[model samples]
Structures are given as structure tokens and as C-alpha cells.
Target: MTDLLFQAFIAAGGTAGFCIIFRVPLREIPICAIIGAAGWILYNVVLLTGDDNKVFATFLAAALVGLLSEIAARIFKEPTTLFTVPGVLSLVPGFHIFKAMEAVMDNNMDSSESWVTITFKLAAAIALGLLAIGAIFNAAHAIFNKTKHVTTDMMGTLKNMTTPPGKK
Candidate 1:
């Protein structure tokens, strides 16, 4: 769809601009742009496929972005946040959040509640999707690196295994 492609292009450009502001390494800006575009295109396509399921569409898009972030982080040796922060900028419903706050100040309780509900649903969808993917990737990374509970305070089980029985 022309609209989808156009939106994707804009998303990519926006991501690049954010990356610049974030001081992301210049060499990786293009990759982050592509990731943002891909996520947006996927989100748009999901929305077009059925009833207006903004939550599900956002969830899928965030999942896609997380997957890309994991892959890019592994390949580029950069933190996933480096790519994810800018990549997700396109999906945030900024206008809705603004409207919700404005409605609250205007004493429009019904409108404020509606907007708040919608914004929370969308945000939860995105957060859950990213959380799911991140947990999986963390598990995989720990396994590959042989670091038991790498992110926890517990000591590495594999590190003990590697040390000799007589070693301190």
C-alpha cells in the first residue's frame, strides 16, 4: 500500500533523526532506521488486515522491533536500548496522551477516561511484547555464554565449574 510505504519511509527518517539526537554511532543509524521502518510497516499491515485492533497491532510491532533489536545488538555489539528507543518512537501514541491530559484539565471526565484507557492499553501491549522478547533473548544469551543467572546477584555457576577443584 502506498500509504503504508510512505508511513514507513517517514518512520525511518524519524528514527534516524532521533538517533542523531541520541548520539547513536553514525555507522549504525541506517540500521536503526531500517528497523524502525520495518516495525512500522508490520504494524500498519497488521492494522489493515482486520478490525481496528490497535493493541494487537502494537504488540506485534513491538515484538518485531524487539526481535530486530536483539539481532542487531548481537551483530553490532551495541545495547538493545540503543536501537529500541528510537525504533519505538514511531509507534507511541503521543497525540492520544496529549489529548488525555488536555481533557483532564478541561474537566471532561468521559473523554479523559476514554483517552486514558486507550493509551494505557496501547502502552501495555507494547510493554508486554517487548518484555516477552527480552526475556527470551536474555535466556538465550545466558545459555550461550554459560552464565547462570547472569542478570541476578547470584554468582555464575559455570564460572565455578570452570575453576579447578583445588583452586580457590
Candidate 2:
């Protein structure tokens, strides 16, 4: 329990730091930080579970983080990409990709295979992350718009829409 809490704090602090450095809104900082922390926790859980499929675990965690970030953005009425991008930084799989490339460069076949596996995992994670975020955001937008009220046009025409038909 303590370990988990500590991990969460680290993840949140790192995410909040990124937001501050990037000049993200103060109001959105806590949301992004929590999202990052959740992603890290999920990642650690998968690692500790002794699952052989690290790739799948990584991808799932990233996708989840992305989706949550999008949700936070919508809730806060901010740019979805802005929140999601920073929140997912902790799960970007950069080290895996680097190790894969290093293995190839060193001409070690065994190391190369291990690195290749990691590379694939990282690639899958990124791809799934982007896909999940895009799908969730799109779906949420649709649903929210459908449930929102309509508006009027300049010529007194009834503009039946959920949002204001402009970027927020």
C-alpha cells in the first residue's frame, strides 16, 4: 500500500512538473497529474503480476492513460491533446525503443531479439494509445453533443447543436 501510494505521488508529481514546465493551466494540473499517476500504477501492477506479455500490458496502460486524459480534458473544458500528451509521457516506452536500437547496433543476436520484442511492445503501446484516445474523445464528443441543448443562428434559424460549433 505504501509503495503504491509512493508510486502514485511520483507519477503525479512528474506529470504536474511537466504541466508547469509546459505552461498548462493551473486548474488542469491536478487532473493531468492524477491521470499520469494512474497510468504508472497500472503499469507497475502489470509488471508485478508476472505476465509474460509485457507488450500487451504496456499498450493497454498507455491506451487507458490516453483515454483518461481525454476525459479529463473534456471535464475541464480544455484542449484534449494538451492534457493527454503530457499525461502519457510517463508511459512513452522510450527506454524500450532505445534498448532495441542499441541491441541492433551492437550486433548481438540474442540481445537483438530481446530488443526487438521490446521495440514491438513499445510500437504497439503507442499505436494503441493513439487509437484509444482518438476513439474515446470522438465518442465522448458525439455523446456530449447529442445530450446538449441547441442554439440559434444569425438569421434566426434554429441551429440544432450540442456544442457552440467552435473550438473551446
Candidate 3:
């Protein structure tokens, strides 16, 4: 139990290194770290629950990361990509990818195929989660812009209607 806690901090520490390398702003570093750590922790939590659906776990974790990135972006007036690019790095399965390639070189087709499938599932989850959030962001932005335009147009129409044609 204690070791698991340690690992979570390690994950966050590693994420901090990524933030540094990515040149994330000092003020926003904490937010990036939080998003990364939360994702790492959430992934483990799902596994620990014995659900065994790593793809779903990754999906949930990435979705949280995207949602948090959007929130942070709004708060700091920064781009979501700024935080998400590095934040997602923490979730990548580097060891799995390495082993997958190693299995391929050893001519172990079964192992290689299994590893590749796992990698694909994890990657797809991350991609889809980000996509889902992106769709939400676009929809919200469009709605807000449309509403603003309609409100302004309505005000202008009301003004014109109240003014007599003779006055023009």
C-alpha cells in the first residue's frame, strides 16, 4: 500500500520532468503536475479494483486529463495543448512498447501480437478520450459564439424596429 503511494509520487515527479522539458510555464507547472498525477493515480485505481479493463481505465484517465487541461487552460488563458501534450506523456506505456518490439525481433509472433494489441487498445482509448473532450469543447464554443451573435443581432433588430422609418 505504501509502495503504491510512493509510485504515484514518482509518477508525478516524472511528469514534472516532462513539464520542464516541454517548457511549461512556471505558474502552470502545478496544474500540469496535478493533471498528470491524477491520471496516473486514476489508472492504478482502476487496475487495483480488479476490473482488468486497462483500456477503459486509460480512457477514463485520459478523459480526466483532457477535462482538467481544458479547465486549466480557461483559468490561465493558456492553450489546452500546452498542458495536454506533456500531460499525456506520463500515461504512455514505454516499457510495453519496448517489450513489444523486443518480442517481434525474437520472432515470438504471439507475444508480439498480444503486446501490439494492448498498445493499440491503450492508444485508441487515449485518442478517443481526447477526441470526445475536443468535440465537447468545439460544441460549447460554437454554441457560445452563436448565442452571442444572435443576442447582438436581436438587439440591433429591436433598436431598428423601435425607430420610425421617417426618422431614418
Q: Per-residue CA lDDT of candidate 3, range 133-167, in tens?
A: 98999899878756333322644654324224564
Candidate 2 to truth, TM? 0.74
Tens digit of per-residue lDDT, candidate 2, span 11-105: 89988989998998887888889888988898888888886766777777788787886677667777777877778887776787788788889
**Pairs with backbone N, CA or C atoms under 3 Å apart (clashes), candidate 2:** none
TM-score of each: 0.86, 0.74, 0.83
Q: How well does candidate 1 match the true structure, expressed as C-alpha RMSD?
A: 4.0
Q: Compose the digit string of candidate 1's lDDT tens values, residues 54-143.
A: 989999999999999999998999999998999888888898899999999999999999999999998998898899999999898778
lDDT of 3 at 100: 94
- Model 2 RMSD in Å is 5.2
Off by over 4 Å in 1: 149-168
As a TM-score, model 1 comes out at: 0.86
RMSD, one per candidate, in order: 4.0, 5.2, 6.8
Every candidate's lDDT = 0.89, 0.80, 0.84
